[model samples]
Target: MPNPDNSTPPIPSSVLILGSGVFGLSTALSLSTHPSFTHSTITLVDRSAFPAPDSASIDTSRIIRADYADPAYSALAAKASKHWRGEWGADGRYDEVGLCLVADSGKAEYVKKSLQNVQGLVKSGARQAGQGRAGKDSVQVLDTREEIERVMNTGGGSGESGYVNWASGWADAEAAMRYCRRKVEELGRVNFRKAEAKSLLYSGNKVIGVELVDGGRILADLTVVATGAWSGKLVDLRGIASATGQVLAYLDITQEEQDRLGKIPVLLNMSTGIFVIPPRDRVLKVARHAYGYSNPTRVPHPEKHSESMVVSLPRTKVDEPDQWIPREGELACRKALREMIPSLGDRPFSYTRICWYTDTPTGDWLITHHPCYEGLFLATGGSGHGFKFLPVIGDKIVDCILGKTPEEFRDKWSWPEKGKEDGVWTDDGSRGGKKGSVLDEEMRKGSRL
Candidate 1:
């Protein structure tokens, strides 16, 4: 919780942002040009160079849709859709192909509420104007599996009922990220550093800055941690935030197959948490938006001395370059392929990777200042859906930093209370699959296969 008086913190002379992913990079961009921060020095640091290869932000594709069950997120996503349709989406960066969202009888609640939200947006004409070819008829409800199959055009259907939002689409994630990075560089207002942050430099209760892995120190008046899944290691986020690794499997297809499937809408079944984004460049992707595997490791608690705690952090290719998803995840993806696109059922996966998400208990982002630390602020907890807001999230984050959090997101983005007695598993009605999976255990199980 922020100060009860609602007094805004003084604008710092120097702001140091850790992590160059969507949150950090966007904050830097916003801080650089914002009128109030004209004299504030901005420094952006990341372990890898721009577009960190192992980052969740660096991906082949990401969904850009506003079909959320929560009206706030749906409205905000619709606002971002406008930017995606503008110059930000130029040069093949974005595509408005459409998204087929479905769910079976048991898990149909989310899809039902999502459909209603989008329909409301459409009826209010908010989802009509910038939808390109999907104008006016942007959303269409599918009453049966046959209707879902017809919209998918894949000769198959998923879930019992759903709807298709043509206004929704996908984006070349890396391209859009690079575009934002270039825009940040062109401003020349930020000092970019390629270095790994070891931990936060705490001066009593106030965070002074960051300590580098090489025993170097960089001090700043304000520090923002936007390290995504890696944030837990830099801050004590135990019950507040954790890293969950989601599985992604890609298959190489022929040019003809790509052309045939590329025109179809992105299919996502909330019931099973399986999704297949249309193929691009002869490669098709199948993934799950479920409660992902947790990689729990013991590390020195950020704010405690001679004490350690177990936190679920990311274990990516950056640490083990040869890493692949667990067999259970692979099989889940296989099942999705067999049921959705039967033609590719027997095809082998060209490659598989685990995409890490910084998940909070409620699926809301932690964008407020640390409840106890004076100079420390957090801008993470993407929970697998932050990429779509890349175009506009930074400015909103800056607003939160300045104590002007948008009314809609004030409570949603605030520092959450301690998690439940069992553990933190996002139950936002969107995530599916089993919870409480351990990464190492799953990997060993995969080895047995």
Candidate 2:
């Protein structure tokens, strides 16, 4: 385990990054361009090709907002929003339709703090600089559900009160990921391999590289496990971080409906963790950002070969191709649709899936060197809010690798002390819904119905 002291480690000659999602891919891009790692050989390996179908990073749309209960993350997201307004967001990849964030009585605190943070950012002129016409006078407080509905421009809306940050928006997730992958390919410095990491290759206590599922070893001077939800399979995340599956249900709409709904702001209710990103390609998605279902499974311990441990890992369509969101999730999505957009309440979901997030108890990302392994670094723990930071997260991750973690995130992203798995649900205030829902149990219950 590495200490949290500001002591720089020598740049490795070869760096192997496992996983190609935001964390891994961004690190690869940053390492390929960073001067310190100019001579380093970077290899990115993932179970699937670029933009894995089951990855949380690949989707129809994702919210892009600077709104956060914490000022630090709000500021960071505001900085990232600048990039979303620029080249990274071009070519129909980003949509600046604004984000309407609301909350009920029970969850109003998070919304209140988030409003203050975004308002502060606006006051400090840290945000709204590059947002064009949409940037000016962006933060608008919605005192009631009616005001929220007005901002949403939809017939209905959730939450008792909230605010709308006109500067915020949404992005075409898959397109942005593809754009990122293409940029990495253009660099030509990284070697991208499509292979599943069976386990970490270790020499004593240090991770030397990764052993592929196919029984081949890829050695590197440093190994970065950025496998997102499946990181627990490679590293004993245990109570530090776990994989939780969030629900997403997409409904197909008529062209007329799309035209009408396309211009509406992205609506999110923090109380229920239900959100509606405006329609794209006549497909409207309703998702929950709650304390999601966990799929616990026993697997060989990465550090101890003879022992196996139960960890909450992702069981996506990749593993069960026909898998769908559990009935509880579907009903939640249905209810959200009825409350948020009454006109489409009866529409059937064209598709539904569980998106897995690498969640930490504090909702902070886990981005630091392994506490016990000298050559292993972890760049995971997205905690459901990592996608918007895509433009700047990589460089920040690189800084951590060089022992220069940002002052604000130094503690937030560091390797945390392990706790009991039963007590590890994220209490970030933003998360909603009942805790401790097991995926298998939920699926079995759904099957019974």
Candidate 3:
């Protein structure tokens, strides 16, 4: 551990990863299967079991949509969408309930381009023989607010135009992760440790390993921190990332209601910051796509970075007991749901969870080396939209570690100035400005946090 020169040690025979969420597991699995990574030992460490209950990735459902106002993200996600098809023997992993984009204007960048993008892919694929059944009847543009409401199976969207990628739908997120998990386990080169990482073990500016909560040491040539909302507590990301909770509501429906709500497409209204997923197993998931909560149960970072703080309020399943289903979050969700599904607004929520996103300055992900510590890298900041890209995000992280990241995504995800990015008029700074918070903002009294 005498790496005083601050230079990278060398080609790592072993990789020690913190957190077994999507990023951690996928990166390990991808590296283990890579021809170049032969014989390399990849160790994945987490505080809880795989698919931990509190992991944002452990939800019963998560939206896997290509609906985005940005073209770059849309293109990347659209290509990765195909892998959702029946992953690991689970049928309908990529359900066909349709991905409906509902926004205030038919001309919204996300609305217009997503329609063209999916439609183009379908038509182009149709021309080539031996194409899979992924894009048949894929895209449909709905003009007028009433039309959007009609497709949404409700009656409140009064001014919007959007489209539906009818071929696209939600993914059984928890199931897909388990599938990948089994595959990783089969590799045998990757080991899972149910231990919490207390801090990074460094040698003069070079990361030599990680220190576990139990006072254990894990030495590796390279250490990648893929911890989700808890990333800030483990390393120094320099304020580029923070943990913000997004709340989702699940409503229990009777068989009759399920028959009607089950077919509803993943309804996303970009203007409203909400989306409704298709009902499954007599339950429907609806969530606000904005920042929900910002309580830092972990030590606050002086620089306000994710890797520098550890969030302790979350468990393997949900947020802290006191943080569950705030009255304000529920009201906001109900209002948004009523806009698209009026019946859902009338029904009480069966349960709620705040999906913690390791949010960053840009809507893009962070998959780069740690500038402060050599031989250490980071691959988090899913920004609430990382699950759907499961098919390929891991390989990208490997590329980041190997210095092979494509130019398009390289700098966009690099560290940023949090104070500058989180300035006034800049909501979450991931997608757009004016993000919602979980504090039940007292807007009525002209008082804000």
Compose the digit string of candidate 2's lDDT tens values, residues 1-449.
36468589888999999999999999988998999998899999999977799998999989999999999999999999999999999998998888889999766999999999988888898986425234346878899888888777778999999988888899999999999988999999999999999999888877889899899999998999999999999998999999999999999999999999997889999989999999988999999999999988999998899999999999998898888898998988899999999999999897888999999999999999998888899999999999999999999999999999999999899988887653257889988778999999999888311
State the lDDT of candidate 3 residue by residue for 159-225, as single tens digits: 3788766666778888888888888899888988999887787677788888888999999988988
Q: What is the C-alpha lDDT of each candidate?
A: 0.88, 0.90, 0.68
Error of 1 at 111 (Å): 0.5
What is the full ranking by lDDT, best candidate first? 2, 1, 3
Cα deviation at 412, candidate 3, in Å, is 1.7
Candidate 2 TM-score, C-alpha based? 0.98
Residue 271 of model 1: what lDDT? 80
Clashes of each: 0, 2, 16
- lDDT of model 3 at position 210: 89
Clashes of 1: 0
Alpha-carbon runs more than 4 Å astray in model 3: 1-10, 86-89, 105-109, 116-136, 154-159, 297-319, 417-449
Deviation (Å) of 430 in candidate 3: 7.8
